[model samples]
Target: MIGIRSVVFDVGETLLDDTREWMAWADWLGVPSHTMSALVGAVVAQGRDNADALRLIRPGLDVAAERRAREAAGRGEQISEADLYPDVRPALAELRRRGLWVGIAGNQTARAAELLRALALPVDAVATSGEWSVAKPAPEFFARLIEWAPGAPEEIVYVGDHPANDIHPAKVAGLRAVLLRRGPLGYLAAEDPAATAAADWRVDSLADLPGLLSPR
Candidate 1:
């Protein structure tokens, strides 16, 4: 197996637990959790075409949908940057300790810096949708990552919970892809056999990351 040298992560579901933010949105919208769950299920049932899924969920929301959801809640409940993810600092630290270059690629707005500071994950570079004006599953974001890291594509592994956005495009971009199976979005991997097949590897927790990338 080719040894992995650099690891890039998808922020929302892969490293950050945005459940609180989602639930908060549901409460604000006066939509029940089950209703949102059903909507998400309906979207996933459409399979790997994320563009189709987004159309069904909330077309206007687009890449900034999560942030828009939080804003729509009207509770003055802004998402704290630090409360974004669980156990991220240690994981990033461990990767660095193992001598791997770390970076992040995801869809986000200007609030990305706040979110990163909140998670406290040590990332050498970041490519956000707001900055690029494009989202993942498109090669542009990953291409930006390559420019940012300037590392060999084969040595970079992209880890994310989304099949269409993260896993598929990383492979298309000539980087290895790892699916993170511990977040809300992880169910797609479980429900869709085809998605599971596309992933180079699957991890249940961020803590397992170090071992997965460690030299054999």
Candidate 2:
């Protein structure tokens, strides 16, 4: 991982575990947690968007509208330091200690951004798809990322749990990729050679990153 100057992490399933979010959705939909988990797994297996799980439960549902309504009803998106993975704090702090510019960016909402900033993690930047109006796996997203990044694409490493969203697209956009094998997609990628192969490095936790980025 030599030549790396910046490390940008994906939010969901990367720095954040997301278990609480899913459970909240299940409660909102009045469905069992196991049902929600099953639907999420089904969509992942079918390679459909995570939103598809909700669509399956309530066809023709306007997810965004529902989110706004949920918020108005006193229950909406919530991100807390408790949602963060155990490795997130120390990992990002260590990256900064190593003089690498650390950031957390991915397909997340404005509220998520605000909540994440509240955590005050040791990172140089924090942004999301909602803040940028461009989602990942899209060239525009990575283009914006490269524009915001402090170094060349090759010098910035984008880490996430999903191969399609993080590894392949980042690599196609000229940034190095790191796959963190923790979430659903990460377990799925474990069975796909191309997924693992696309990442410059595969790690079980963010703790592995500082050492990888260390000068060799």
Taken over the whole model, the C-alpha lDDT of each candidate is 0.71, 0.90
User: For model 2, what is the C-alpha lDDT against the true structure?
Assistant: 0.90
In model 1, the clashing pairs are 81-118, 82-118
The 10 consecutive residues of candidate 2 with the worst lDDT sum are 207-216
How well is each residue in 96-201 modelled by candidate 2, as lDDT tens digits?
9888988889998888899999989999999999999999989999999998978899998999988888899999999999999988998898788999889999
Q: Which stretches of candidate 1 lie over 4 Å from their true place?
A: 48-77, 81-85
Regions of model 2 farther than 4 Å from truth: none
lDDT of candidate 1 at residue 148, scale 0 to 100: 71
Angstrom error of the Cα, residue 73, model 2: value is: 0.6
lDDT per residue for candidate 1 within 42-61, as digits (tens), equals 65566544334334455565
Q: How close is candidate 1 to the true structure, as a TM-score?
A: 0.80
Evaluate residue 116 in candidate 1 and report its C-alpha lDDT on the 0 to 100 scale. Answer: 65
TM-score of 2: 0.97
Q: What clash pairs does model 2 have?
A: none
